[model samples]
Target: MTSKTLSAFLLNQLNELKDRGLYNTIDPLEGPNGPVIRMKGREFVNLSSNNYLGLATDKRLVDAAVEATIRFGVGSGAVRTINGTLALHVELEEKLAAFKGTEAAVAFQSGFNCNMAAISAVMGEGDAILSDELNHASIIDGCRLTKAKVIRYRHSDMDDLRTKAKEARESGAFGKIMAITDGVFSMDGDVAKLPDIAEIAESYDLITYVDDAHGSGVLGGGAGTVKHFGLSDRIDFQIGTLSKAVGAVGGYVAGTREVVDWLKARSRPFLFSTALPPGTVAACIEAIGILQESKQLQDRLWENAAYLRRGLQALGFSTGHTATPITPCMIGDEEKTQRFSARLYEEGVYAKAIVFPTVPKGTGRVRNMPTAEHTTKMLDRALAAYGKAGWELGLIR
Candidate 1:
């Protein structure tokens, strides 16, 4: 097809998305992502970032980044196999392995890439993977790329997983079986039942994978979800991100030393992509150190989450089945949810609406991420705005 025809076809889809209120507009932030952020020249309470610890702008991490940059210069200069793996990367991997209580760890450029690389590296062609239906987009893509038999279990439904596991095993049509789940469901903020899943995996002799992207630095006093449930030793692949609470950019998979060794030799992304910059690696090490040295931040984060949840409930807003700092205020209609989010932004809160494709068609919501850095006063202001938006939109009586 000609470029013009392709553009016309793409624009038609774009217009359809806009008409349905599902087209997202990027809002550029003028300042750092904090409790209060300036975006598009408007100051608003920022509740949309994954920076749960608010360490993205922390002075200590900044200093660490600066120091590493000065010491190592800009980039690693080549792919990992070709002089790209620096001392900083090695140190960060060691720190992460210790932090997550794993035997060893392997770092990748991003959490999504970690999923893409690790899942496909271990479970290819003839293998079968029983994945959670609501697992992240990255996990879905990883499974597809592997060309594995992807059997989806209902979200956190142990019964469904057991049924699928039984069926897959009885068929005897796979080389290996693996079960994967998000340590915490990002949208609903519900935690995965890791202990139960681990037990099932043990019974089926299936490899276990837990993508704790939303659980690290928030659970187990900062050790992550697997350790929170004392399953670090039980789970095979524990994938996590340095970008969220860790306040840096990259991802890592912690597992048996053999797994790390295998990934080093076989993972396509790790072998081809340039390693993380020295400064970014150093910044992550510092972030992990901070998380380990203190539970004060974690405590404060939970306190803020609890306070926000109570406030939203008091206002009669249905804050779905969330157990973490991720709070989603349910508004069924897509347009109404988008309007609710727009009103929130206008009222000085910067939460974005999530609609179809991200969530089920009729279950749109405005997700709120209350951070440790948000003071009680800031949260109170955000609550007031939510109340106003709720009442104005008739979301609550």
Candidate 2:
């Protein structure tokens, strides 16, 4: 039986969210999350996926997953610390370490869990974590899980970070100090100033952590943002997600052997959660191999991003300072942003609106993710839709 008080509270909160245009409505995709997707029996140009290299639907990945599934069955059957550490998992970790230019790596079920596990496992009471103001939700939650003092600096403000780091270090109030940030800020599509961050970390003797979930397979010829700035050896922890550019479902932390070993021994998620499926591990392995073999896919991804970004700007839409493929068409009002997305849907495009909580209030936008699979024709169609929608909604001329 449902408690009336609980039910009333839920109803009130939901009603308030809906009234404020902050409630998100989810639509199920009827087909694969490719360059074009179908929802509710209608196909639309898919500009809303994290499949940066279009490897999600790649034949090689599909084949690899199928073969592994047939050979190893559907599930791993136990947690990683117990009996679930399959050979495929080990191989995937090896490949990940190699790709990230690290000595060792550990995998987790998802990027969120990886952050939750890694951050909490290492940071605790008497320690402090200096985090970016705009770090991902997972990072924020992970920091919360630990008993550490979390200090948030301005988003990508190196000077603010330096000030906080110096204050934290000089006060001697904390035992260990760590500086953490996202390699790419997804909402605004801006890359983090990793070199500057690294310098500050060195000056303050702070441990460096970079969550490169949106940067892997898109920078440094596909090595990631750490490598993009030639700071792979300097950054202490390199976190990435296989679900995005890798086109699989998992996350990993690549670092020195000691750090990886410590995580494997102490991380709660690694000890309690069931391991990733063999098929998924195999697929991830294959994707890394593909990325290592060539830069063609990365090239295509950049080309498509540039094409879409240029088109949107030509249509008089503001795309925030994006240094990578994640392009956001800035629309300030929450209701108007939602309406613009709906208008795009009506015009056969599937760009989703990002609102408050995901981004700050009054900074709502329709985030467009142009992938390697997006052809010129598809981009043209999307641009046309943006033009019409913008003019009709008084967002553009």
Candidate 3:
């Protein structure tokens, strides 16, 4: 096709996205992604961030990042195999292992990369992965890349998992088997049935993988979902992201020393991509230290979530089955969800509307992530705006 024709086609697709209310425009935050963030010269009660423990703007983490950048220069300069493995990387991995109660740990460029690296390294073609239907996109993509037979169980449905697991094993058609689930479903804010999953994995002799990206800083007093279920020593692979709770950019796989060794040697991202910057590594260490020091932040975060949840329910809005600090205010239609999000923005709250392909089509919601730093007063203000928007849109009486 001619360049002009290709350009026209691309533009048409973009227009279609706009018409569908799925074309998201970037709203640049002028300041740190704190409880209240400055955007376009106005401050909004920032509820869209994954900075669960509010470590993104913590002074200790900031200081550590700055110090590391000054001491180690900027980048790692090459991939881990070449000259990229810095002392900070090793230190961070060790720290993560201790935090997760694992024998060893391997760091990757992103949490998505951790899933991509770990899954393909262990389970591949002729293997099977029994995955939760509501797992993160990263987990889904990782499973797809492995060329493994992806058997998806209904979200947290142990019975369905058992049926699939028994079938995969009885057939003797797979070399290796894994059962994967998110510790917390991001869109719905529901905790996964890790206890049930672990039991099922043991019964099927499946390698247990839990991507605790949302759980790392919010659950088990910030140790993660494995610890939340008291299965820290039972789960095989516990995947976590430093970007979300740690307020840094990277991911890690915490498991047996053997798994860590395999990833270091064979994982494509660790082998091919440059290591995480010194600043981020240092910041992650600082963030973990904060979590280790006290449960103050975690407690405050839950308090804020409960307060916000109660306020939303009082306003006659449905919070669909939330079990964590991640709260979703359910709105039925895509356009209505978009309009609700826009109205929230206009009223100075920064939560975004999650639509189709993220969640299911009709279950679109305005996902609110209330952090440790948000005050009850701020939540009250947000609740007022929500009530106003709900009434205006005829969503609540």
Give a tens-digit lDDT track for model 1, residues 142-235: 9988878999999999999999998898899998999999998999999999999999998988999999999999998898899999988899
TM-score for all models, in order of appearance: 0.99, 0.99, 0.98
Per-residue accuracy of model 2 over 229-318 as CA lDDT, tens digit each: 999999999999999999999999999999999999999999999999999999999999999999999999999999999999988999
Question: Candidate 3 lDDT (Cα, whole model)?
Answer: 0.92
Candidate lDDT values, in order: 0.93, 0.95, 0.92
Where does the lowest 10-residue lDDT sum fall in candidate 3? 24-33
> Between the candidate structures 1 and 3, which one is better when assessed by TM-score?
1
lDDT of 3 by residue, 1-397 (tens): 5799899998999999999998888988787888899988999998899988888888899899999999998998999999999999999999999999999999999999998899988888899999999999999889988989999999888899999999999999998999999999889889999888888888989999999999998898799989989998889999999999888889999999998999999999999999999999999999998898899999999999999999999999999999999999999799999999999999999889999868888989999999999988889889999999999999999
Please say which candidate is ahead in lDDT: 2 or 3: 2
Cα deviation in Å at residue 196, candidate 3? 1.0
User: Model 3 off-target regions past 4 Å?
Assistant: none
User: For residue 117, what is the lDDT in candidate 2?
Assistant: 94
